[model samples]
Target: MSEQAPHPATGLSALLASTPFARAYTHTALAAVFAAFAVERIAGSVALATILGGLAVLGVGILVARRAEYSLVRLAPTTLLMFLAWTLTTVAWTGDRGRTLAGWVALAGIALIAVVVALVRDTLQIVRALGDVLRWLLSISLGIEILSGVLLDIPIPFLGIQGRIAELGPIQGIFGTRNMLGFATVIALITFLIEYRTLSVRTGVALFSVILGGVTAVLTDSPTVFVVAVAVALVTAALVVVRNAPPERRRVLQWVLGAIVVVAGVTGYALRSTLIGVIGAGTDLSLRTDLWSTLVPLVRFRPVYGWGWFGPWAPAEFPFNYVNAVLRESHASALNAYLDVLVQAGWVGLLLFLAFAGVALLRSWLDASQRRSVVYAWTPLILVALLVDSLFESFTLSGFGWFLLVLCAVRAGQSRSWRERMRSLDGPPGGVETLPAAGGVQGPDISRG
Candidate 1:
C-alpha cells in the first residue's frame, strides 16, 4: 500500500480556508494582541507595529478575496468615509508627520479588512466571531492575572509590574495603567451583563474578568476611573432597562429615568473631589483638577483645530519640556469623551465625529423600535459606554475603539437595509415572502425561474 500523503492545507491553513468566521475571529484576536501589548518603546513605535499588522491583514484579505465569492460593495461607503477621515486628520492635524502618515495607512488598511468582513459575512456570523475573540482575550488576561499573583515572590521582571501582592487579594490584572485597567474592566463588565441574557457560561467568565478588572482599577488608586466606571455602568443599566421595558410605559419611564441619571451624574462630578476624599483617593482627584485647570486655557489657544492629534500644542515643534506641567500629565480630566475630542480635533473634527456617531445611534434606536434584532440593543449601549470613557481617557484613537465603531456602523446599515427590503416584500398588508427576483444572480436554476 502507498503511504498517505499529507494534506496540502492542514491545521491553521485549513482552518483559515474552510471557516470564514474563524478567519475573522483570528484576525480580530491578533489585532487585539497588538492593541493591548504592542509596546512601541521596546520595538519601534505603535505606528510601526500597526503598519506591519495592517500589511499582514491586507495580504490575508487579498487571498480571501481570490478564493471567496463575496461583494465588497456592501461596506463601501463606510470604508470610504473611515479612510477619508483618517487621511484628512493625518494630513491636516497630526503633528508627527511620519507617525501620522503611518497611522493613517494602518487605519485605512484595517478599515479595508472591516469592509471585507462586513461584506463577506452575515451579521450573526460577525457577532459570534467577535464574541469568540473577546472571550479568548478575557481568558488570557485572567490567566495572566492569576500567574502574576501566584509568582509575587518570584520577582519576574515584566509580570511583577502587573500587580502588587497586596492588590491581588480578590482580583488583579495587568494593564497599561490603573485607569486603563478600570476602563477595560468596565467594558468586560458591561459585556458580561449583555452576555448573561444568552450565554450563561460565558457570562460567568466575563463576570470573573470584570471583578479582576475592577480590583486592578482600585489598586491603580485612580479614583477617577473607579468613579467613572461605576457612573457609566449605572447609566448603561438604566438605558437597557428603559429600552427593554414594556412598550406601553417605556416612553415616559425612559424620559424620567434618563433625566434623573443625567442630574445625578452632573451633581456627582461637581463634587468629585469631595467624593474622592470620601473614598480615600483625594490626591488623585486633586491632581486631576489641576490638570483640568491647565488644559482649559490650552483648549482656548487653538480652539478650532486644538493642538492636533495627540497634542499639547504640537509636541514635535514645541518640544514639551515642562515634565511637571499639568498639560504633560497623563489621562487626567473630569470632562467627558466629547470634550476630549473637542480639545484634540477641535470643533470641526468633533462635530464630524459626533455626526457619524449620531447617525449610528439613531439607526440603532430605530432598529430596536422595530424589534428587528437584539444586536440593535447591545451595540448602541456598548458604543455609549465607550464614548463616555473617551472623555476621560484617550481611547477614541485606539485600535479597539475604532474597530468597534466601524463594526457597529456596518451592522446598523445592514439591519436598516434588511428592514427596508422586508417592508418592500410585504407590500401594504405586511405578510409575504414570494417576491420576484430581479435580473441578477437568481440562483443556480435561473433559467427555470
Candidate 2:
C-alpha cells in the first residue's frame, strides 16, 4: 500500500526537530542575539538596538517554539526571579513612571532572550558561538583602528574610534570607550582560552583567537582590564588545582582555595592606598569615588526604595540629572555595580542582587569543581570574571553585562539546582541527573555537580 502525504504541520515539526535544522536554528538564533549585545554602538541608539534585538529575538523565538521544550516551573532560577520582582515593584513607587517602565523593559527583555538562548543551546555550543563572535568583533575593531589611525589619520567620531593605533597604545575599539574595549577583550580572552582547552574549535582557530584577544587588551591600555585579567588568571589557577585533585580531595581543596580568596580580599582592602598607586588604577579609582560621593544625598533621600531603577542613569531624569549637575560631568552609572544598586534600588535591592549573584556563583563553582569535563569549568570562571569586574564597573547591571549574568545563572541552575536533587529521589539510585533542556538534547550527569 502507498503512504499518504504528511500534513504540513507535521512535516514542519519533523524538520524543526531534525538534527541539522536544530543546529542551524541555534546557531542563527545565538549569532543574531549576540550581535545585538553591541548593536547600540553601531546604530548609536539604545532604543533602536533594543527594538532591533527584540524583533530578532521574537522571530527566532517563534520559529523555535514549534519544537522548543521548556517548563514554566524551570524556566529560570528562582533567585533571579526574586531580584526581577523587586525591580518590577520599584515601578509602583518610582517618580518617573514612564522611564522606569522603559528601563524595566530593557532589563527584562534582555533577560528573556538569555533564557531562550540557554534553553536551546548546550554549554559547549554557547562557548563556541561566543568564541566565534568575539573573534569577529575583535578583528573588526583592529581593522577599524588600522584604517582610522594609519590610512585616514583621523578619528571615526561616529563609532568612537579615536585613530590612536598609530601611536601603538591606548586605543578604544568599536565599543566607544577604551575601558569598555578592554573589558570586552578580557571576556574574549577568557572565552577563547576556555574554548581552546575544551578543544571545541580548531587548534589554529583557537590560538588565533587567543592572540587577537590578547593584542586588543594590550592596545586598549586599560588598567581595569589588566586588573581583571590578573584576577581571572588567579581564579583559573585555583580552579585548575581543584580540578586536578583526586575526586575525594576536590571538595577539601575548594574550601582551602576559597579561604585563600577571602584572605586575599581582606589584605587587598587593607592595602588599598598602596595597591592603587602600585597598580596605576588610582585615577580610575578616584573618578569612581567622586561619582559615588554624589549619590549620598540621593540615596539618603530614598534609603530603602531608592530613587528608582534607571539602569543607565537617564540624563533628563530628575534625581539622575541633579547628580550629574553637581558632579559637573555626564556619568551614566555610579561605575560600581554594588553602589549603583544601592543608589538606584537601595539597601534592600542591593542585598537581593548580591544574593542572586552569590547563589549562582556558589552553585556554578561547585559544579565546575565536581564535573569531569573542562567544558564544565566555563560557567564558574566567567562568573568570577563578571563578579570581580562588577566591583569596578556597573556593566553587570544592564545591557551585555545583565544578559551574561542571567545566562550563567540559568546555565548553572539547569546543571545543579535543588530540582535535580528531588528528581534523583525518583529516577536514579545514588546520583542526580539533569533533565534535558529541550527535546533531542541531553544534560550532564549531576552526581550533585
What overall lDDT, based on C-alpha atoms, would model 1 receive against the true structure?
Answer: 0.52
- In order, the Cα lDDT scores of the candidates are 0.52, 0.75
Each candidate's TM vs. the true structure?
0.70, 0.88
Q: How far is candidate 1 from the true structure (C-alpha RMSD, Å)?
A: 8.0
Model 1 pairs whose backbones collide: 336-391, 337-390, 337-391
Write model 2 residue lDDT over 1-449, tens digit each, in one string.
99999998777666654545545544554454444434565665765555646544653544454323443546678888888888888888888988887788778777876765565566766777778777888898899899999999999887778899989868877676788788888888888877777666778998899889888999998888878888989988888788778998877787888899999999999999998998798888988888877787778888888878879888998787888899888988888899888888888899999998999999888887777667767888888878888988888987667878888898888757765665444443212234332232336632211
lDDT tens digits, residue span 1-449, model 1: 99987676554454554445445544554345334433343344565466557644754744463343323334444534853474456456555666555545655555555544544444334444555555555455556555665655343344324435445432333444555555655655555554444343464665665565455555555555665576566755665676667889877886787589678879988987677678776665466567556656666766777544542133333222231353555343223456655655677767767766767766765554445334345666656656666655555455555556655666566556434444354332111112112211112211011
Model 2: per-residue Cα lDDT at residue 300:
85
Per-model RMSD to reference: 8.0, 4.5
**Best candidate (score: TM-score):** 2
What are the clash counts of all predictions, listed in order?
A: 3, 0
